[model samples]
Each structure stands twice: as C-alpha cells, then as structure tokens.
Target: MTQQEKNFEGSLKIRLYNTKSREVELFQPYFAPRVGIYSCGMTVYGYAHVGHIRTYTNSDVLRRLLEYAGYQVTQVMNVTDVGHMTSDEDAGEDKLELGARREGKTPWEIAEFYEDHFFSTIAECNITRPEVISRATEHIGEQIGLVKRLEDNGYTYKTDVGVIFDTSKFGRYAEFARLDLEGQEAGARVAVDDQRRNPQDFALWITNQPNHIMQWNSPWGRGFPGWHIECSAMAMRYLGDQVDIHTGGIDHIPVHHTNEIAQSECATGRQYVKYWFHSAFLNVDGRKMSKSLNNLYTLDDVRARGYSPLALRYLFLNGFYRRDMNFTWEALESAQRGLARLWGACAELPAPTGVVIPGFIEKFESAISNDLNTMNALAVVSGVLETKGPPESKASTIYKMDEVFGLDLANSRTRLSDFWRLRGLRPEHKMQAESMADKREKARKNKNFSEADRLRDRINNMGFQVEDTPQGPKIVPMFDFDFAAMRKPVCGHCGVDEKTGC
Candidate 1:
C-alpha cells in the first residue's frame, strides 16, 4: 500500500451508528481513502423549520468529522424540487405544487425561492455546502433510466397510477425497518391501494393526473418520478451505484430509505450503501414540532428572539445525534450563555500561535470518533478552556476543536466586534466606549457607586452599552448606528458640520 493509504488506515478511526445494524461500528469506507456521502436535502416547499435544520446540521457535523479524519469526502445532497407528496405514501398532491398554488406562482418558482432560503439559513449555522447539489426536477432523465433498469430486471410492475417496485421480489425488503410482512400486508390493504402486489411495495414513477403541474414525458407514460426514486437515482448518477454513507432523518427509514435500498440494490445487484446514518427528531417544549401545534419554528424565529444561529447549533451539539432533542427556550438560552462564555474565553487570548495541546486533541478526537458524541466533545472543549495552559496553546487547541464543532471559535473576536458595529458604534466609538468601560470597572472596584453609576450613564449617553464580565467590560452599541449622522461632512465653506450647521 502507498504511504498515503497507510496513513488513512491508521488515522484516528471514526465510529458511527449504522441504522441498518442498529449498532455503533467502525466506519470503513467502501473505497479506501475516499468517501462518498449522500444526504437527503430539503424538500423546498416552504421555509425549513428548526426540526429540518437539526437533521442537516447533524449530517454536516458527520461530514466535517470525516474530513477532519483525513478522508477525501465527496458529498451529494438531493434537493427535492419535485415528486414529494403531502402524504409520504405517494397518495397526495405534490408539496411543491401546493406551495406554488398557495403563492400564485409556478412550482419551479416556489422551489427556487425556498431552496435559496434553505441554503441561506443553513449557512448561518456554518454548514458546508455539498459538493454536488442535485435537484430532482433537473434529473428526470436519470430517474426514468433507473426505473427502466428496475422494470427490465423484473423488480418493477405497472400499476394504474404508475410503475411500482415489487417489494415481494426483494427478499430483504423489510430488513432495515424490521417490518413484519404479515402485519404490513394486513394493514397495507386498509391504508393504501389494494391493487399493489404487496403492501410494502412503493412507486418508482407516479403517473401524473391532468391537473398535475410538474409532469415530464417518461417511459412510464408522461409521469413524474416517485419520491424514493429521486435520491437513489441522483446518488447513483453522482456518486456511483454504491456510496460510502447515506444520511437522513429517522422518518425516512421505513419508507423512503427502505425503498431506496430496494431499488438501488435490485437495479445493480450490488450493495447500495455501506453505512446508513439517521438523525432523530427535534421536539418543541417536549411536544413534537408540528404546524398544527403552532410550534414549528424557522431560523428566523430564533433570530427574531435575538439568538444567534450558532447558538441554536450549539444547542444541538449538547445532545447525541441519535437521540431526540427537546427544544425549550430555557435550554436554548443556556446554550447561548455557554457559547458566549466560550467566545469570551477566546477574546482573552491572542491569535492562535502554538501547537494544539496534545492531551486535549486526543480527548476531543476520541469523543467525536465514538459515534459523533458531540455532547461529550463539547465537554472536552469546556475542560480545555479550564485547563491551566499557555494562552496560545488554549487558543490553538480551541481552534482545532472548532473545525468539527463548526462554531467559528477562532473568529470570536471579529464576531464580537461586528456585534457592536451592528448596534451603531463606529470603530473609533468602540475604542472610546471600551476606555470608558475600563474606568467604570475601576470605579466599581474602589466601591465608588456614585462614580461607577456616573461612568455607566456617560457610556450609555454616548449610545453604547457596557457589559461587565470577569475578564473586564464588553461594550456594544445601544441602538442602530445613525449612519446618516456619521456621514455628515464638515462644511468647508462654513467651517461647521454640514448637516448640523454647528
């Protein structure tokens, strides 16, 4: 083997729970030294809620961890601009069509709008964009090709509505979901079309009705691809017939992912994916997040309450990816405070200079390697901060941790400065504000309450707010900067401020 191969094989191993095996196992790539990852991307019907964000964030962390472990990772995320139905069972109107009708626009327009919004919000949380972002609507030909292969292979049969995959032909149909065939057969007749060969059988293509808006001419009689077929076709088209890893929400397991496995494997007669990773749900105030409950929150909702997007990211890191995360404002506030404390620590140190502390790095790698146990990984960060070490070492170590954490710790000082700049203060005003805050700190230390209050009022009057911290005082602008006032030039003709006439 080449030296590079040896290095990757010997690198700190990453372990993740495979939903297929239902056990945490060492991650072995199908192709050594290179990993192909396929994550189910947003459906793009509307603004993505926090529940959706949590799933994608977990996948991002997994990708980041693999990259950090020295794997050449090629990631593909499929944007479902078409085919996904209101009912996951392929029985209802397309979500994109519904959204388009509601907004009085084309389905294509609605997809583009929400897809842009989805990326914008996830970017706020520092998610790395996938290498290949395949859209279902753009890959209709590939989807039809895959279904044709399945049909030719005798794994698909014609249904009144479309071509359906014959789950009865795939012996391992219920393997991943551990479904009871008899039970499924009994319930399937009542819940779905009785004409289906088997209750568990799913559609590969859905024949469009007269009013369906996103129809494409296909071998399956001018129909659209089914929801499950999109990811399988796109993944195989981009990443090959077999991939290293596939990730999605747990909700995909029983139907979506299960069907992907069946179709992909039956088409190629090869194992489709080596590892299947699924993230659990997000609950709001101990209840499942739903529009009916009026508890579905978007990234804007978090920002509306003055919380940073990374703060919500930090909140997710506090829990295991495999466990359902309970979201509460109180819990989120706690995470925000914790993140601020870490950022505060970063501000006290200079730019990273020294090598990463070996002990801390080991513990962090170990934590993340063990099934992406980020909660424990975060505790290691807290431990590193409290360790008595050179300032440069701590900063350098935290910077290394942030690679996997995606919290932007190394740029905390810049973020802090920008925080104040957004409120209203100019660069010079920020400096002056800090100087006054130092004076107020000394005044309070000397027990001069009157003087301290006086200094506080003086800073506030200058349109800045001071927050006293153990490290000293942090200054922020009290309100939006009056840029118009700041832009007022001195009137050269009158020797006074142009706007103020002073």
Candidate 2:
C-alpha cells in the first residue's frame, strides 16, 4: 500500500498513472516521508493562454493532494525566461523572436511582459510560487557545467552546429516514449536533423546567429543553452540531480521532455527524475487549444467574455486530471452554478459544539489520496453535508477539503437561489459563520461578555470575524490562508519573497 493509502482508509488511495509502469501504480516517493517535486514551467517567449493554466493547475492540484496526505513536499518550478527555441527540436530561431516579430517589440520586452504577467496569473489562480523558481537565462553557468560533464563522460560530441548529447551512448535513450530504436529515425521529429550524431541525440548548446536575440557567452563561444539543458541544470541545482516527481503537459512526453531525460541522466550517470506526471489537454467545443491552430484562449479572452478565472479552474476540476476535458462557456457557467449552490447550502446550518470529526476527515483524505480523485472527494464533501453531524464538524471538513480544491467556499453566500443579498449568510445551510454568529449572539444575549469575545475569535479562525452590536453580532473575514500556506514553511525553503526577505 502507498503512504496515502496507509494513512487514509475508506477513500481510494491515490494510485498514480506512473509513466514508468504505464499503469496506475501505487505512488511511492524516492525518499520516504519527504517528497521532492519539479514541475516544467512556461518558456515566457510569448503570451500564455488558458492552455498554460491547465498544466499549472494540474501541478498545483498534485501539490495540494500530496500535502493533505501527511507527507512533507518540497516543490520547484522553473521560469524559462530564455533559451527555448521556436522548434523544440533545436532547428529554428528562438521562440522570443517569434513573439517579438508578431508583437513589434524587443525579445527582452516580450519576455519580461509575459514573465511578469505569468506570475500575476498564478497569483490569481492561488497557485503558490515554488520553493525555488529558477530562470533559465540566469543559470547559464549551470547549464554549461552539465554540458562539460556530459562531454567529459563521452555522452556528448561537438558538431558543426553545437555541442550535442549522444543518445546512442545511453541505454534505453527513448525509454519514456516506449519507442523501438529500430524505427526511431523514421518517426523522428524535425525530420531527423542531420547534424545530430544519432537521430535522437539533441543539442546541449546551440550557436547564436545574428538573428538570435537570447544569447549568452559560454565555453563553446557566444551561444545559448538548449531548452532541454535548462531544466536539467535548474532541477539539479535546487533539488538533487535525481528528483521524486516531474510534472508537465502530456504534450511534452514525446519530444521536449524526452530529450531532457536523455541528456540529464546521461550527464549525471543516475536517474533524472522519478514519477513522471503529465496532464491531459483542454479542448474547446471539440477542438484542442494550440498556437499553431490559432484556437488558444487568453485570460483576457475569458474575461472580455465576462468569465472569472476560478470559473475556468472549477470547469477543469469537474473533470479528472488524466482525462481530456472539453471547455465551453455553458460548462463554465454550470460550474459557477455548482459553486454558488455549494455556498448557498453552506449558509443554512445550526450552531456547533466546537468538536472536530476525525472519522469524516479520514474518509475525505482517503478519497483525495487515491490518485488525486478530486471528483470522488467532492462527492464525499457533499455527503458530509447530507449526514447528521455537528455544524462545527461539517464546516471544518469543507475547509479541510478546500485545501485541495482551492475553492473559496468559506467566504461566499451567493449559492442559495432562495437566499438574497443578506450580507452575513442565508439561513438555508449550516456554515461555520452562521454557527459562530449564533454562538456569539447567544453570549451577547446572556451578557457573558468574556465568552462572546472568545467565540468571536473562534469565528475568525474559521475565516470570519464576529462583532456584537445593538442589533446582533456581525461577522467578517480578514484573512483566509488556504492549503498553499498551510505547509508550515521550511525556514531555508525560501521563495522569491522569502529569499528577498519581503
């Protein structure tokens, strides 16, 4: 049994679809009790579309699920502010050139614009920054280090074009793709770039031409690190050379990430990463979103059409991670309705006993533990409401589940169709706010002044503050720290803000 399964029973222990085994195998971390994670992030050469959000949210969900399972997770995601090429196969100009040409801006301007906005988008979605958010352009020395190492180990050979890693030297070079080497060249991407020693071998570094805007000085000369080399160097520098989990879009599995694994493992003479995780794509009205197809949806596109970002997240959550989901305005509207209904139901329950329900928490935890089956865990959340329980227990449970869901369930009351804009809550369902309000009001009515203040503080912990007035006690929320902040931050595990001492 996996750690998740062992800890939580009655719920499906998360059986991850391990790319290694090609089956939903029990999730086992390389280092027991502590999990180290790396996620492939944006290239920042162009504007990010909703397609990008799909990948980030998938990673975010995995982080949330792992933490809820009672293991310490240290995650690292990179920012590719430089060195990604137009063709991931190492043939064309840098992608930043394409963005600059299309937008009539400098390559640096394009990178900074999208890179800044990318962080903004993540904040909007409530996805916390990784412990170490590295920039590929800043790590030129590190990439060069790995390139030299691969060269020293005979895993690399310098070609007229650049220094390339010889995939032929590594056993099972295309292992991730489950490819038969006999037919590798026949099916190779970019028509088997003739410069490569073997058809599968990719560039460790590429020479920068006059047209290439993102260039850096290296041992090879004035050039840039190949896209594959950046992730390998960055992941190793922060987490060890071998990591626990590597996540990204399924689209990366064939070419980009495949090259990364070959170069990384060959350079280090050890496993590159364990537990590869790839999320399915999002299709809109039966068509997949992509730049070439010109069907990508931007954040502004969704908002100009009057949709919230969370509405997009809620739509994705309605479907499972491994399955391709169809996105539509109607589908998102339906998710909004579901969210509203959930908040509506939350506004109507009775007062509490201040007791937490361990049994119910265990059940919900198990549901999410089993392969991040949020679809099932959500069903259990609804069940918690239906069952007989203290109002306090039910409220605490929803708050706990939101650790994975990232939904603002504790702060809204617009779901109840029957409930109007009664600022505090609608009396349809039992929410912690209503229960705490009841307690505070009772204390005020009895004139137990000290008890009223303490109950007000209890309400605040559940994400609302209470006040006793002439009419009654009014509740409001000052801060609501969700799952991302619940990790109990490791002191030296500083993020961008923590590193800057912000």
Best lDDT among the predictions, by candidate number: 1
Each model's total of backbone clashes = 1, 14
The TM-score of candidate 2 is: 0.77
Global CA lDDT computed for model 1: 0.85
Per-residue lDDT of candidate 1, residues 24-142 (tens digit): 99988876688999999989998998998899899999999988888889999999999887874666889999999999999999999999999999898898999999999999999
lDDT of candidate 2 over 1-502, digit per residue (tens): 5765345544324567777667777776766567788999898876677778877887888888887766678888888877666664665877887888899998788888999988888766667677888888888999999999888888878876689888888787667888776765553456656667677777888874656877888888888887788888888998888898999998888777888888888777788887888898888778977768777877777655545566667777777888898877778767766765676567664433346577767777776777777777788778888878878778877777888887766654532321222222222212545566786678778999788777665555444556557767665443222212323322121111233431
Off by over 4 Å in 1: 1-7, 88-91, 185-191, 418-449, 457-502
lDDT (0-100) at residue 471 of candidate 1? 74
**For model 1, how many clashes?**
1
